[model samples]
Target: MTKQTGGKRWGRKATGESAQVRDGRPRRSRRNTFREDEDLEEQINFSDIKRIGVYLKPYLKQGAVILAAVLSMSAIAVAIPYLTKTMIDTVIPSKDPVKLFTLGGVFLVAIVVYELLLRYRTVAITRVGQLMLKDMRRDLFTHIQTLPFSYFDSRPHGKILIRVVNYVNTLSDTLSSGLINVIADIFTFLLTLIVMFLIDWRLTLWSLVLMPLLVVYVLFLQHFQRRAYQRLSNKQSNLNAYIHESIAGVKTTQTFVREREQFQTFQEQQGQVRKYWMKAVHIQYLMWPGVQNISTITIALIYYLGITGMGGVQVTTGMLIAFVGYANNFWNPIINIGNFYNQLITCSAYLERIFETLDVRPEIEDKPGAVELPPIKGRVDFNDVVFKYEPDGRNILNLVDFHVPAGSTVALVGPTGAGKTTIVNLLSRFYDVSEGSVCVDGYDVRDVTLSSLRRQMGVMLQDTFIFTGNVRENIRYGRLDATDEEIVEAAKAVHAHEFIMELPQGYDTKVEERGSTLSAGQRQLIAFSRVLLADPRILILDEATSSIDTRTEEALQAGLAHLLKGRTSFVIAHRLSTIEHSDQIFYIDHGQIIEHGTHEELLAKKGAYYRLHESQYAMIKTANGEEG
Candidate 1:
């Protein structure tokens, strides 16, 4: 299948190639192996931690409310145990109903206040988390728009989509509540520890005996958990990319009768995801049980010491019960902290992918102090232009120079991959030339802002992209402010109105993405209408009519003449008939212009242009079953 890259098309196969050697050596598929290598090299560094802090910085007010609520809740927790001790030791012994009733009312009020504070904290944390996600997704999407064609060309669309959607979603809970809860858990632990010591230092010290062992286990689990989650993320990304590719080429697969093979490939990719997911989950499951076992052991040991008075300290019934309560409170926070630590490790992997996408600076941004271009007269000049798609790659255009007068049509004819689209792409400044300049009306394209330059140019590609909207809305995409009548007129000018009106709802009929319901000729006509509405001073039609039928092409020729009357047009068409009457024709070959003249002038010389013309005519004759 051929994927559209701005004006150019890149042909790639649906299935991935093997990374194995030709001499029967075994190796992994290139797609899976490449992602694995990338994941293996990833690390969670300090810079990533700092970037996470930046997203959280804006939610300080919300954080403050959540912090206040958590601290208040912790204080109440510590006080409740003391109230129980007071009831057992003093109130009940005095046998005063008033005192007992007063303490009971206080207990009820404390529970109510704690529940209210918990509710407030939940609301505040949720608000901060959702807003942070919104900002991150917005920033990532905006940055993606400014990225150059090369960025999208190099990576699968599914990989990019995962970063913007799934990866950002993975961060929501961790950033919103997980981070603040970790802080709250630490404070809760410290507050409980101080209270436990004040009650009885002997039991407090006994509770801590098993803590070092728990710490050692967590440290051992951390290493394997981090690695497991990282591998799982890589597998998920590979599976996502494969799914996107398969859906896009489902028609081609059906045509080639490869559905069974495609399903097998999907099963293999999904199996990898399942394997890594189980590994990560197994490592996570160990954390809770390990902490729970230690807590149970410590509580039993505290009971034995207090009942037998082994420490030579007097132990009362009320004090023994109160100290046990403090021990549970102290150990519970440690478990919470351990769980938060696991979340931090998992979120770090997602954060790395999100930040990596943001760090890529746009290659085709405006220069410092760039100015908006004034209304152009459409005179274009390519002055000793040199360009290549890659920094170290060979030049696609080498010192190729050309000039076009305002209000003239020039045709570019060349073989496939002969830099025909590169010439037009340079004129639109989709890429900057490695050497020399491409100028419009004596202004260097790079010197003007990209928006201002592109706004004055109309570009229609062979693969016309029709968005999922009504016909009128899609055409109005060319000029957002265009009125309904104006949209109809442009469609009429491009001869698209007749077919559009035939749809169930006329111009208001809804179309699917990429216009699956529309015929190739109909889609091209709508695209042509869109370009006509823009009415750009410089127009580029790259294989604009190649998809349309011969009858439709003939009808469009009249509309094409009207559209090109006062615009400086650059047309690249494979059909020789479309450019036979162009003001000037340049036969491009091997990144160089080998012949240039009008149709008659080039034919008189019997050069490369004449040979191309003769071959095309012969093919036409053969198709009509006529003697050539």
Candidate 2:
């Protein structure tokens, strides 16, 4: 390809081009994709290209149908120009009105058939694309669910959200539209070029001489467009993170009068997005005009050459008309193909971000031979347990040994960041212990299947999470098969039934997102009610009653006394008054259990537990003095 070809292929706005006279030897023609096949040459980003090809598999059938329709339309559409040639050569110069009428009728029928075919083709292909998208989306969601929580903890929530929503949507749209259109354009362009050559090779060669320049223009657009879009994607992720944090902490913002500060930050980011978007649009704006002007000049060349070269032969009006039609049809696809090239480049970053998540291998997964753990005798033991969140973060637990006799209740107490919750997490196997073993009924927790192990231990995390559903539905989330009457019974047992019934729609009232409509204590009650319905043999409650008022706490304490009668339990709470009823108390400090006994025994010993208990007493005394 010549310099003109290179320049046309690489759009004017393309930034990566080396000037023809660079450093030393003439810029060794970069391996032109237009001139070389994959088998004959190498690809710059071969792996990325291959991955893109894999994504196209789901749309292959829809693509085939689209190809057939587009080519059919183009073939017939191109035929009209050729038919005009025939009429000019044989009928128009002869001025046969009968032939004109007959030909006009034929043209009318062709147009009707073409319109109907395209209509059905669009509908059929759209339906197929939608079905494929549905399946892809389902697979993406299911795969994400299986990923370990650590993956999410490492990344910002807004980044994950953008990949899930925007990236997937872009991939789906590209597969459905861009991929189909590009393939059809290639097929039509090639076939039309061949026909034009057969009609008159000299004219065909002269008209497509500008093809090299067209290719250069397209190449330049793809390069800059890629960078522009990638910058825009990063900006979008930042904007998403800001919005997520702002909305999630809306109350905190209002409490501290930081609304204006947040709004200013948001404005700055929004302006950044506009800047990146304009950079991309600027390239696009440069592209169409350049190509249109170049083509318009090419059109003038065609008209000048046609009239001059054919003067002696008395060439008919039909040939001139046909030449004009082909000139118009020829470069439009090049323009379309150029636009698709940019679109393909822009969505590349989106594809990479999305697949990066999908490709992640879970740190821990169920073993091949892992068997379902059957009912156990409710004995638990922690032998030399040691654990931490990260290689560098503070240790949440250290090597130590502890055991609970079958069906006994144990309460864990600690200062903030003392790793009390870490123990619960280990037994639940959310994170495996860094050192030591945790066993239940003689089987190591890690040896058993995750589903079976988790199913057997009921957990109520400190932060109560309730899905957006009706009151009854939220409770039933713990055990999907639970009947409505069973759901009501569980609520009653937990003292949540009375409050639930007072809601406008009773059991059917909708829980707003994050359970926002309900008070914190009310939300806690629903969470416990759900746990009550689950009825696991091993119950581990973390700050379970911290939100309840004195009256509700008394009622719940009474209900829990009856509920904990025969079940094994681990209770962790900050309120010294709450776990005073436990059979044994384990005081945790710096990830190690320092003291263990009944509450009175620990207080009498005047150890770490004694100091913690007295601090709470002092706070109470101060409150009483102020009230007096």
Candidate 3:
């Protein structure tokens, strides 16, 4: 393992090969090893700790209270040992009833005060910790939003979720109580040491003879403890990623009767988590016995040597008794400190992962001095555009040059993987071109703020995602401030109003997550309605009408044509009718436009486009007995 350096950052280029099959399923690996980064670094630097300190800065007043409580609690704990000595040597031996009662009352009052301070400390620190967590999680989620698509593309949903939820919660455990306990233990240890020395310095020195050995043993165990926790953390992330994938694709699993297989995979992941946890536990458990044995030996030495009055220096019974109490306090605090150190080691791994994500700069961020895109006229130009998903990979689009006049309809027709979607992705600036520029209204896309550029463009993809919400709420997602009337009008435009009204709760009907409660066609219509409500100047419809029935599609096409009349639109479709009315068509092949013209003009050319149209849709036309 590498020692952590002060400076290391998450590189922008998402680095990973596709671990998926042609069917879009992740390839399963039989290898039992988790992400065992042998060169994984240890030690979060002071700068990262200071970043955390910034979170605590806002709760300084609460921290002051907690500090006061901790000091009070520690003082009371030390006082109890001294009070026991006083009672045994003074009040009880004096044979005065009044004095004994006074000492007992004082002890009871001290206990009450200690309890109150402990309670206050718990409440205040817990409140402060919760507030810090809220701030941290918010910052993380907000930062995630600003990240480019490639980050999400390379990482698993479950892994991200774990960082936001479980890992943050783990940090909360350390911040809220673990840290305070460490501080209290330190104070208790020091106070006990001072009092023990004042009582009998010789005995105190003798009792701590085994201290260096204990320290050495704990320090050795720490390295193993850290390695075990790293493995455990990696296993948990893997398990969560698998579970998330499984749950997200449960319908596919059930339909294909792969539940048993998936269950077996889950069991394997679970067993790995348990095995790693046990290894960590094995290391942690060693501390308890090691500390116990050393502590026992220390006390035995103190008692045996003190009975002989160390070098003719006499020792009183009360003083010896007090020394023993202080000895227990001294050794036990070491054990507590060891436990705290172990927790810090475990938490450090999680902290590193979280910060690594935060350090990744967005690959497609606007350049310095980028401006807000003006109201665009929607004239897009691709000037010798070249792109590849990977840095050194084959170009997906090679020297592509095109100009789309404002407010024109262009149909993209191609085979799968023929760069149909890649063109649109570049146009939207979802990714930057590798070797050339994509310009919107003469302004290079990279020179404009992403929000201003994307806000004016609407894309409806083949796979429509519907967030869990009521029908009205889902429609309003496109324009957050859109009125209910405007939402209804948008739905009506897409011919979704009729079906939506027929539902039990109409517009108020609650949709399940991913719109599972809605039919495919219904979800597509809702997605169309959302885009319509947004009323973007540039519209992209990729297989938009594929899911609707013939009659419903006809109705939707009318609304779509009305919506598309004055906007620059790009359409990708397989159906002949969907592109039949397009103003121009670009027939692409092998990342180049082989043919481009209107439908009739392309037919007259009798080239690639003509053959493609005839072979692809001619059979369907013949089956319907329609003129080809």
Candidate 4:
């Protein structure tokens, strides 16, 4: 292939670019995108609040204790202000030293008790919130696993990660500190207002006159606050996505010497994040100053009324002082609540994001009465199967029909985008067929529990993934109950034992993430061992040996031939060796099998498979001559 043709083929295959159109029009993506015009308003929903409340239900008994503690703290706060009023009016005015001392002692005792209650409430509330957070994280992760592959394919990995991490962490404050603080502030505000009215109704009215104006201003600030926070959340998610992509593809970036370009891109994303954060800060600054100014004006008005003895009421010094105290208490809670209102507004979007993930129903789930499939006999059949990743997108597999007899090895040969992988995906039931049925052992794969069906099938893909663990542990992942001896035996069978034993720690040698420390050939060998340990009745290898060295390929073919015996296996044919030995060969193109026969039979026909074999052989010979 020419360089341009090869690049185009790889690009279209990797990104599903070839399937991006239907009927000569571009296919619309199903992915959701964040847009500024999309519902920037934050409206409180009772159902969402109620759903969060359910998380607290399991800790209801403990929540009550926390509630009681919070209530007591508020009550004690109210009592302290009254005690000061009494000490100033009754205890001090008459010069009664004994009463003064006694009141002073009582005040000291109240302070100590208040501190104790505050400590209890803080610890109890925090602990409960933490427990609730734990449960929410667990549920979110478990729910993510149940979602269909298409759900993940539609969104960036970083966006999903942000929901699982930053967004969930944001809930911790609301669950623990935010909930209790809001309740406490509300109660304090009401109690202080009552006491103010009792002290002198005239001054009380003066202090509250500007209250509605403050509320209106706060609401105005909150609108901007919510919008600013929404922007910040969007930018933060974008930044996370960029960072994850950059790290994963750093090798490519370095090879192309695009570090400077990537760094500039990083700076641009960071700049966006900073801009949104500053906008939120500016909005908050406007709100807090406005609230404080209104509060100060109210205090000034109360003092003016007290000094003048307004409304024909005598305002004693003690009463005036006590009223001022109540006035401060009254405004303090409003300010606190106003701040918290902004917090809730910001968190509202994050909450919605989290709930959106939880609300997704898996596209392919077990039927209500789906039975657990017994051991599969490996007979696979596809009858007029049609499939599309998106409902409105081009059909990936159109009216495809094929059958693999029990205990047979089938090699699928196709150019890129010929629906080779889609066949295996259907047989495994990763997705349900859009039309007709995929049957394994005479049972529709969709009619069986997903776990029961998948557990009995093993897939070794072109890109082998070795998780972060020891060699032994990675192999044991196929069958968690496998003994160490069995693991080593499987490794030896795949010719992986010699290299593994030479590693720094032998079987216990640490594997880096994605097995980056290992070569391509070594990773494929480890993958082979993983599959062998599973010993499934049906095995699918999609270009599994594509990365192995010529020498290693020779060693693996012996073990693979033995392993393929009496098991239904589908291999996406690339190598001549793999195709030649198959019980049957299928030459597929454009979602149709153009030819099917043994190696000798296909050569005699001199059709599509013949051309493909000739080209591949010529390329190999040219490569060998160049090496020489």
Candidate 5:
């Protein structure tokens, strides 16, 4: 073995005749051991490897102990063949019983010591490998979390998950399996070769004639199996997409009585997997037969040459036994090297995905030297802001400017498709403006850290999202450290305490997945309580009561009014009753504010807001005699 280093990087590349096959074999046809160094060097961006090396610094001492154990264990493994040689060549043949018994005793003792060192080395390597895997996973997860929303929007979650699950796992696998196989195989192979040559060079040379065939077979496995594995990964990701979409819309399927259709769709997808699995299996099937043929050929050569004594040499029985035992050694390493090669190539695409996410620069982040937003006064402003969802989509907001004064309530009313929601999205910094800027309390929203800016605002959307947890934990999600008393108080303030207390375990009851156990009205009350616990100085109520029954809406309206007082509030309302009492109203259409005034002023003008409010559809009632 030799090390090749340049730019302080390590690679093992055998050169010239060392890479050649044995005599009497066509060496030029055999595959070379080393990869194309320049190709790998250019492709594998191991920039963070230096960081990984730093992590290994603390483990060097333990690593040294493990290395010593590995070397000693290897020496003991090599000792077994030599001891048999000694018994056959000397003690037993000399008819010296005492010498035979002493050799037997020493062999027993060596086996005991070897087992201890082997166990210790296994534990040490595993412990170090696990620690490194843990640190690597943490860093990868953190990097992924910081990536921009657009990154996730463009990429599938299953593809990203494959990176987190399978790709990162490969970081340690190189050390655990690929590396261990190479070292153990080379050491055992080398020691056996030296011993076989010493016993009879002619026989050793003949035995090695089959190596070229073995090397050729392994290279084919590496190439074909690698391609198969990639297809397998792609097929698996497709299956994940189907499963995610199916589960997400299970209700729609059931409502339409489409269970059979859904099952048929899944079966079609599973059928694809079966086809790919067969291709992968067939490629794998070809490898073992190739290997078995090489082994069989080597044994045939041995018998033919040995029986004829054509080389003018008498190969002893012990030598033949040792050579047969040595031949079995090739089986496992040959298979493992092929398997590792397959895994390595499959993970390459996954690693690219993970690294791409990690390398993304967030669209919004705290600027250099950004300072804390101290004691906000609840003032909000958007100046000459122009924005659109896509570059080709109609401008969601044109050159619009708006302001909400401290200690005031402002309502934004418009027909459907008006940019009412966009206004609130800008205020929350869910997105930044395409032109101009939004400022909160004299600080640019982008200049302030996201966490700092978000801490000062409370948002209640039309679609209330509740995670799977008990009522207490869900309310406390707003402020994780809130005391139980504070959580209960917030719930009571929102009129949610009555409904929560009636559940199976009061605040401790587990809300089913996505809070399916709760009604839309019940969930919204809990969501409002969640916002109340955060105690933001600026609040957004964007159709906050849209999904509730009239009675529940009425019960919470007073508390909502109280919550709105003394805070810069922006309310996006479709229902005229919700926003009629605001200090100011902005009637937005086609991404522009066509009118702005008090509700009475807008009503007097008989503009867009007035038209929407006057429509009979706005007050349609159901058979239950409730407002639509």
Candidate 6:
């Protein structure tokens, strides 16, 4: 049954080119190309602030405790100044020892209570900050896992790492303590202002005369400060991306003797980081000193008015002292509020990047009411299939049509980039068809849940990935519930048991990431064991034996033949000898199948498949003749 399909593509193509020589200069990695536009300027918006508030909602009880502590602290702050005035104006002059000692004891107690509240507030704020950081990182990581392959393909891994780790950390303090302190500081400012007014309204007005100057200075610095921080963040991400890429490709760099060149590139990126950091730090430093200078002027004005009696209001020594204390209390909160505002500006840069990542909807999410696929007999069909990596890109697969009976072995023979792997990718639903249906057991792959559909298929790519773990554990990854005995059986079937047992600890021997300690042939054997253990209904082997020696390849054929029994399989390989006996052989080129037949039938036809076979046969004979 043929179904015609055409619609907007779900994923965008990455417009990065591979590294190559051009104009006598070695080109950069594709990952670095995408960073060019990543530093676009962005302004913090209300939505970003509102989303941060959502993360804070779960810790409201703790926030309330913090609020109560702040208010109680503020009340004590105001009351202490009044107590000082009472001691000087009334208690000290009374000449009564009882009153004097009683006032001194009360002052000491107030100081102790204030310190205790301050300590509690610090602990509470830290607890809340840490909790919010955990939640933010969890949500970010969870969302990243759901994003389509294209999202990762377009950007460097280091950029994503920084957002999950560094950016989230940058916002934690601002979202928790910074936000709470801003609120507390405002209230404290009001309390101090009111008390000062009651003491001497004239002096209070004088203290606030320098407020306009402070406001103008803050407004002037606001735009430059935020922009500087944003640039710094961009530069930091670029440097991290280069560092990660360098580490991953260190072998290639050393093999090519390009260490000096790589180091030069590293220095250039690091210099950018340092330059932007200095710019941002310079802007941030200006804010504190500017506020402090304004604060100093305000205090000087208050003292001048109170001491000189310039406004003709009589001022007693105790009233003057109490008013001065209130004035300090008022300015301290302003300083705190200014610092919080600076923190808000800095965190806003991080928040924009974090929310931008979280806001991307997964392009390949299950549709509403999608159903789980039941176990299948592995009958697969590609009906008029057409695909493009990009919406407007050239077709990677065009009008391809085929069907495979259940339990049949099919070989896809083609040159590199001739849509061989893409065919299996569609069958596995790693990508959706651009204009056709990929159906297994008559169910379109997209109609089923991803986990249920992919669970029954095993794919081994050209590059085998062996995670960091013991040999036994790595084999068990394919089927987590498999027994140790079953793991050994699978390894033996793939001809991997000999080498595994040869290791110092046998199956318990630990391998580093990517199996760097093992030979390429050994890694391929382990990968084969992993896939075979799963007992998948369908399997795809894309150049699975490319890394193995001729002797090992010959040994693996017998085990592979037994595993392939009663399981539908697709094989892609350059060495045609391995697939000469496949139930069906397809010679695919330029996204189209040029020839299709069994080995003998294609040889009789004397077409593209026959010519390919003859050429490979001649090469082997020539090599043997030369050796003889």
Better of 1 and 2 by TM-score: 1
Per-model C-alpha lDDT, please? 0.83, 0.75, 0.81, 0.80, 0.70, 0.84
lDDT of each residue in 1-628, candidate 4, tens digit only: 0010111111112121122332343323235432111123245433445578878889989988888788777888887778888988888988998999999999898889889988998888899999988888888999989876667776667777988899889888788877777888899999888887887777778787998898789777777777787778788887887887889899999999999999998898889889989998888788778889999998888788888877765787778777778888888888888877777877776775676567666667899999999987899888777777655556677666778899999899989999899889888887777776789999999889999998989899998999998888999999999999999989988889989999999989999999999999899889989988999999999999899888888887876778789999998967876669898888877766778888988989999999989998999999999999
Question: For each candidate, C-alpha RMSD in Å?
Answer: 6.3, 12.1, 7.2, 5.8, 11.9, 5.3
Per-model TM-score versus the true fold: 0.92, 0.87, 0.91, 0.92, 0.82, 0.93
- List residue ranges in candidate 3 displaced over 4 A: 1-51, 96-98, 311-313, 625-628
Output the worst ten-in-a-row residue range by lDDT, candidate 3: 1-10
Worst 10 residues of 6 by lDDT: 14-23
Q: Write the per-residue lDDT of candidate 5 for residues 1-628, one digit (tens) a residue.
A: 0111111122122111112222332222121111110011113233433344555566778766776677676667666766776777678789998999999998998899989987886777778877766776777788778655555655456555656766667567654434444556566667767776777788778877877877777675666665665566566556666776788789899999999998887887777768887887788777667767776777677777766777865766555555555555434445555555545544554444444445555555677887778768898787777776544445677777877788678888777887888788777777777766789877888788788888989999988999998899999998999999999889988889998999999999998877888998899899999998999998898898888776877778776777778888888877777777898888887777788889799889987767876773445544336632
Clashes of 2: 15
lDDT computed for candidate 5: 0.70
Best by TM-score: 6
In model 4, residue pairs whose N, Cα or C atoms come closer than 3 Å (at least 3 residues apart or on different chains), thus clashing, are none
Per-residue alpha-carbon lDDT of candidate 6 for residues 1-628, written as tens digits (9 for 90 to 100): 2222343444344233323332344333334441452643345554677787788899999899898998888888989989999988998889889999998999899899999999999889988988989999999999989877667777888888999999988886786588788888898899999888888888888888888998988888878989998888888888888888898999999999999999999898889889999999999999999988888887777677777889865577888888778878898898898888888888878777787678666656577888999999999999888888766788777778899999999999978889999999889887788777889999999899999888999998889999999889889999999999999999999899999999999999999989999999899899999999999999999999999987888889887888899999999998988998799998888888878889999999999888988999999999989999
Q: How far does residue 524 in candidate 5 sit from its true spot (Å)?
A: 1.3
> Taking the tens digit of each residue's C-alpha lDDT, what string does model 2 give over 336-441?
7776766677667666555555666555568688878898767888987767655454456667578888778899998888888878878888777776788999
Model 6, stretches more than 4 Å misplaced? 1-37
**Positional deviation of residue 582's Cα in model 4 after best superposition, in angstroms:** 1.0
CA shift at 472, candidate 2, in angstroms?
Answer: 1.2
Off by over 4 Å in 2: 1-62, 171-173, 310-317, 392-394
Candidate 3: tens digits of C-alpha lDDT, residues 1-628 = 0111121121123222323231333332122222322124454333445477778888888787798789788888888878888888888899999999998999999999998988898888888888988998998898888776666666677777888888888888778876667888899999888988888777778887898998899888878887787778788888888888899999999999999999999998889999999998898788889988999999888788778876554576777777777788888788888877777877777776676556655667778999999998899888877777766667677777889999999999988899998899888887788767889899999899999999999999999999998999999999999999999999999999999999999999999999999999999999999998998999999888889988998888887778888899999987767788998898877788778889999989999888888897767768678643
